[model samples]
Target: MLDATLKAQLKAYLVHVRQPVELVASLDDDAKSNDTWELLNEIAELHPDVSAVRADDDQRRPSFLIRRVGTEVGVRFAGIPLGHEFTSLVLALLQVGGHPPKLSEEVLTAIRELPGDYSFETYFSLTCQNCPDLVQALNTMSVINPRIRHISIEGGLFREEIEARQIMSVPAVYLNGEPFAQGRMDVEQILAKLDTGAEARAAEKIAAKEPFDVLVVGGGPAGAAAAIYAARKGIHTGVVTERFGGQVLDTMAIENFISVQHTEGPKLVAQLEAHVAEYGVDVMALQRAQALVPSRSPGGLHELYLASGATLKARTVILSTGARWRSLGVPGEDAYRNKGVTYCPHCDGPLFKGKRVAVIGGGNSGVEAAIDLAGIVAHVTLLEFGDQLRADAVLQRKLRSLPNVTVLLNAQTTEVEGDGNKVTGLTYKDRTTGVVHSMGLEGVFVQIGLIPNTDWLRDTVALSTCGEIEVDQHGRTSVAGIFAAGDATTTPFKQIVIAMGEGSKASLAAFDHLIRLPAAGEAVAA
Candidate 1:
């Protein structure tokens, strides 16, 4: 049930309902069902267009359906969608009740014309920062087309089902009873995966696009800032990204972003997206850049190839592709990934409730993950390759204060041990004594560091030994008219504010490169 303050906020949001909405809940004698019944009643009273009733639409108990009055447009919930999913609930109510979803017209049409029947079952955690995107996206698709139905499940409340399915990650999605995806996914990304010819069609469309004056690849804070700055200069600007938010979407708490005291990653990404949209910057989402072919001449045109078989030409290019979580190449690590190995403690931590777990790394992320998981899991074993932890003194102190935490130094993770279905333990080597040991645990959280997303640009640009794009102080890369920024580049600290500043600097450097170039088909100025 919602409290007085939450009820007031829900009342304000309910005013957007232009059509009738109904809440049909399937219940039992359980406490969750009781809470669901009360929550549905409270929501129905918030607006005249909303109503609540009892029904067995689906056999799942303590679940509900938000259906439009006269149409099959709505979504189903396998458990009470609250906490991180509360936003999904609110957006579903509004979209199904005639409030339009914030999707491009092209995507909206694609969802409407989808041919096959799709029944999506998304398993999510209430604390996951990346789960809402898929939850809200599929819910909106169900509204767009009658053939598509989405049922989102809260993984914490359905432990038996999770174990049976061997699901170890948040936002694990299944399409028609088969594993579809296991990470953050937006509507466009989902459509690209579901529709077979969608990629080819998109490729052709992108190939036909006019060459941009300034083109940016990646959609993190750096890419967003670069696109905005370039667009402000009255030049043709475009940004292509596999997803708009990047790794920032996976981040849970962001309190040190300067100016603003506190904000979630999703909220910040939403604002960044909105800000980019305000400027007329052409946004090409759900596209991956496969290779970079720099133009031989300055300010001529740079060719960027996409994995979708599309090619984009730009006068200037800013590579802002961000980094991803570093993987432990140890055997069984890959096989056990999403089976018990994960990177995010905030999202998937609850799934390992009262279970023994290990955090590999000695840095801030590892210590923080250990501290956070110590509360939920039965015990925490932190294995560090170095002799001492590299985390801040404050964080190390806090991690040591936890009674359930155990720290091991000079320990090298050798292999992840699993039992075909799920992980059962780990193997590590003691560097000092050259002895091997094993620890029985249910989960492995890798927080060593980040690996830059720069494999696609390997031979095209000069890169550091660590694979980060080599860039000058002004953000100019080795290739003329080509610039780089953010985590993918040779930038230090790898913070959000630094990435934004670097992006602006790259845009300015790109603009300077552009103005000095001679007109098309003309020689250089004397």
Candidate 2:
């Protein structure tokens, strides 16, 4: 099933495999084992350095052992790696065979201090963009310490185990049979789970923060950009976020960020965090900003409360809390999320290549997604709830031009029909005919609208009717010392380039506001 272009790319990447890697497939009586064996044999055919070896049912049931030719890190995949997760399988082999482990000293120390033997059973889907990150991080830990082990299980291939665990999402990590995390995670997050010391150190750092010059609320593209810009002004800036990457971590491929032709969401987020680390900004991660209390007096410090009961004071604040994808709220949609139902077309579209897929929504995003998926998938079915599509004329025209694309108007998606394993079809009601129909497809993409993360700031700042924070041209909100940017604000566009520009503007405006501040002594008395 590998295309020539993709095969070429795999060959190029395989050349860097310094040591021989073995794929020892332990087969069972299950039918899925055949599928797994087929995929592995195909992989072996493409790369001279990769060899597939089959084992009888007595050895183990449907597990692929991946290790260096001579050494064993005990790396095993319990499921077939398809879709976006194929990259994870490739990286796992390269990481195990190519180079020495390059984990930081702090992470290494935390691994060495593990209380006991820990194993991570990470359940994932081949189409899930976020699953590989957790799997790779956990795999690295296993390579460093023999006590730690991880098994990557593809949710589709191993349906029985996933159903037993009641898993409905990707990156569902279980530490020693106990649930650890459900979604995208970082190395520090995994470390914190392994030991309480990591969490304690983070809490201590957050509690020790005092008043600062600038405070950026979110840690997405806009917030990270704002923090870097503010710190460059030689001010003691602080950033409080639930996570360093914010919504960007949930995203997949980002093809349009300027200069860089192609990049994924996690890669871009890593770069953002790395760039922010170059400055002196106090980054308080894993803390959510719960409340905003304006300064009592002009030029005084504003008190920002976190969900952890910790309050941080800042002279100025920038709100860049990003937005989230709106769900269809249909039956089976939630149950099959990350199973065969995905929200990002750019990130997971490649996984559905040559497979029939459907895009739900008639807006610009839906049409755009349909157009994008048409090139990759065998067929694209676009469903619109309204009598007509809400997308722009130009986009609608472009969508109609694609031969493989089919648009259905006045179609209300009622339920996503899926087996216990993956999506089987889409069921929708035709408003015009009052008839419900099911279309067979392997994947479904939901592209309705973006819900801004501005509910928390409604009482503190001016918000649009749609719940986006209202900001002027200078990114200034109704509050004097507060500014907003990016998707959370009233910005017309929600692209990464636009968000970065907005962040730069907001930081510069915050700097300007600080320049007009009175002396420290006079500010307290005001």
Candidate 3:
């Protein structure tokens, strides 16, 4: 559909940049739109350094074609890049970038084999900046492959649709006519869900008959500790976890947890699980607690429903669900995570020994990670997107005294670059001067704050404005039968020791409450 002269020029431009280019057009014959094919041809001729091509006939009629010039990649969009359709460009670019992105092989294969056309609609708000990364990730997937499409609608723009879909929060994604996923999602996860949807539906139908007693949400230190204590008390305790070990599992080596001078996160989790298993704690992995409901009776009996349709009942509840690391949501950050990217310096810092690394964030965690890494890594670059470090003066002093650490204020991460399988470097832009520069690094650790896992409790329990469940000193939630602990609660310190301490206290409190209930019930019956 494109003019040969323009296509030739675009091909030349791509060659100049040494990247690939792709032109994607819609397949809907009845759909009215501009002549994207002709426009691409003209652009191709105008920018000969970039290559232009069309999707193969067998690949599907509505799909696009991708061609690599040298190293640079370009996309000629046949449709608006806004909304759900924008994902195409991101996918194409990722393909041109020579990385498969962060998708599982099985899911990727499934997506490749999918035929016809399907679209995903995600509803979100501008206030939810977190939603954009998810949108971009989906878009990237759609671009590389034609079977998938993504659309993001601003919640405000589609208020009626959002209400009808029951979208009470930001970042809710829907596939076809059914709700697919919500909140922050990576490409791999999205693909996996798509591939397993049928199986998941079948499993859900089967799990509806079973229920649990004392459902301990989360598998982090606090949740694990709670489950162990509850099981030891002879309560039928079960743990439903989206992922085992919560945030702590992502940690490399924890030196601060008392009694254990240095221990790997996974190892620690395994030990915890072993102890928990001794008491026969029912461990359910890869499941999330979607909601909690209190009994209609006066006495506090609660029910917990999981996303998988499994229901749980409890005389008393303990919420040890932890928090997650907040991301900068900038370009390349997600793509490079764990490749040349990391969230836990204590886990991955030593891996960068004798190599350059960057630590993004200026808070206490960032300062601490920088200080810790400076001693092991060859050179450490600390970037603060703010005007100054928010860490205490003592930590700031310690960071400043470190010879290997270089702190840059008002700096922002622009992109992460990698060499095929791993991270090679990153680019940072100066907020004040608007100048961008790239630095080679073996790794980049992101230490930006955390978000409590308390969104689902909004209606069931009282939560702080920041989404932390409010609890008494003894970790008792406002609800008489419900208790909370660790990072999920409004605790000041988020350390492992602190979380464990809270778990112990909450368990003791729950035991005391349980003890009182039976005696009072006997007296009432008499």
Candidate 4:
């Protein structure tokens, strides 16, 4: 289902396979197993150096093994690779055969020093853009160290295991049968968890006399830009974030970032991080910001409390916490998410080309999604919970202009119906008549709304009715010395380019705010 351009890229990538790889499918008479077998066969046909084989034993029927021609890489894919995860399967093929390991001496040393044998079972879905990265990282680690056995389990194919583990999200990794991490994890992050010597050291509780000139919260695109700009001014800059790449890490194809024709989320995030690291910014990753409280002293230093019981004091703070899509709480919505139900049409819509799909919600986003999908998919079903669409008249008119688009008003999506492997249909009810209906489709896109990450701000700053932080034109919040940007603020049209610009603006504004303050220790000298 790849486009011409993507197919060309894949072919070029496949040409570098040094040794032949074998896909041994151990499949039963199930839909997921059959799908996996078919996809493997297709992949084998695509690459000259790859071939598929069937196993006679029932013990390993549903599972597939990918190993180099002579060497034993011990990589296992538990299900079919589809959606965004297809990239991971391709990468695994490249890395397994003749491609040198991409690791630093320090990381290699840590991997070799790992004490005992551990099996990493990572739960993932085909549509999850973030899962592939973690799976690839873990698999690479397994290749590096023989003691580590890693398997990428397709969550949709293993529902019983999912129920046993209570895996609600993709990329849920477990090391030695215990939970390791929940989201995308870079090599450094994973090694930190594995190597005891690399674990974070405890710091003694002592109130700091010195303060940072600027502190950027949230390590998303906005925070990365803010930190870069702030550090370039030669000021003491520090940034604390739960994850280095916020929502962007979960994104897949990003074709609209300006100048870049094609780039995945992790690739762009790596570049953003590299740019920020070029400066003198102290980035504290995997640190959650608990509360933002102003210092009791007269100098107006703001203290940011972290979940680890540490406080970060700064002269100015920039909020770029970002936002997440509002989810449908109905049954199978979470289970089938990233399987056949997706959130980003721009990212995952192309994967379902020539297949029927539905977009939930009646707002501008839903109509726009329907309009976008109608061109690619065989059919587009737009279901709105409201009596009428809340989209602009122009967008509504354009949506109606599409030949394959069908609009359903006052439709309440009750459940996302799906087979054990992928989405098959959706069940909804008519709000006016209370009549329930079902429609067969391959994908469901939830376009309701985005929930900002400003709830943790509490009553400290001015907030909108929907909990979005209120900020002025210069990215300055109602409270001086504190600024907000990106989806966390009242910024219209939440896009990466806009967030980067806003972050730059906020940094310059913070610098302006700092220049007006008394010189460091000048008041004390007085």
User: For residues 239-316, what per-residue lDDT tens digits would candidate 4 score against the true structure?
Assistant: 888788888886666888999988878778989988998996888776778899865543579988877667788999
lDDT against true structure, model 2: 0.83
Who wins the TM-score comparison? Answer: 1
TM-score list, all predictions: 0.97, 0.77, 0.54, 0.71
Ranked candidates (TM-score, high to low): 1, 2, 4, 3
RMSD of each: 1.4, 5.4, 16.8, 6.4
Model 4: residues with Cα > 4 Å off, grouped in runs: 1-74, 77-115, 121-128, 153-183, 188-211, 252-255, 261-264, 296-300, 328-359, 364-381, 390-406, 412-445, 524-526
lDDT-based ranking: 1, 2, 4, 3
| Tens digit of per-residue lDDT, candidate 3, span 348-420 | 4534557799999999889988998888779999999999899999999999998888999999888888866
Worst 10 residues of 4 by lDDT: 200-209
lDDT by residue (tens digit), candidate 2, 256-371: 88999998887798799889989967887778788999986778888888776777888999999898888899899988887779887765665566789999989988998999
**In candidate 1, how many Å is residue 521 off?**
4.1
Stretches off by above 4 angstroms in model 1 are 56-58
lDDT of 4: 0.81
Superior candidate under TM-score, 2 versus 3: 2
TM-score quality measure for candidate 1: 0.97
Clashing pairs in 2: none
Query: Per-model C-alpha lDDT, please?
Result: 0.92, 0.83, 0.69, 0.81
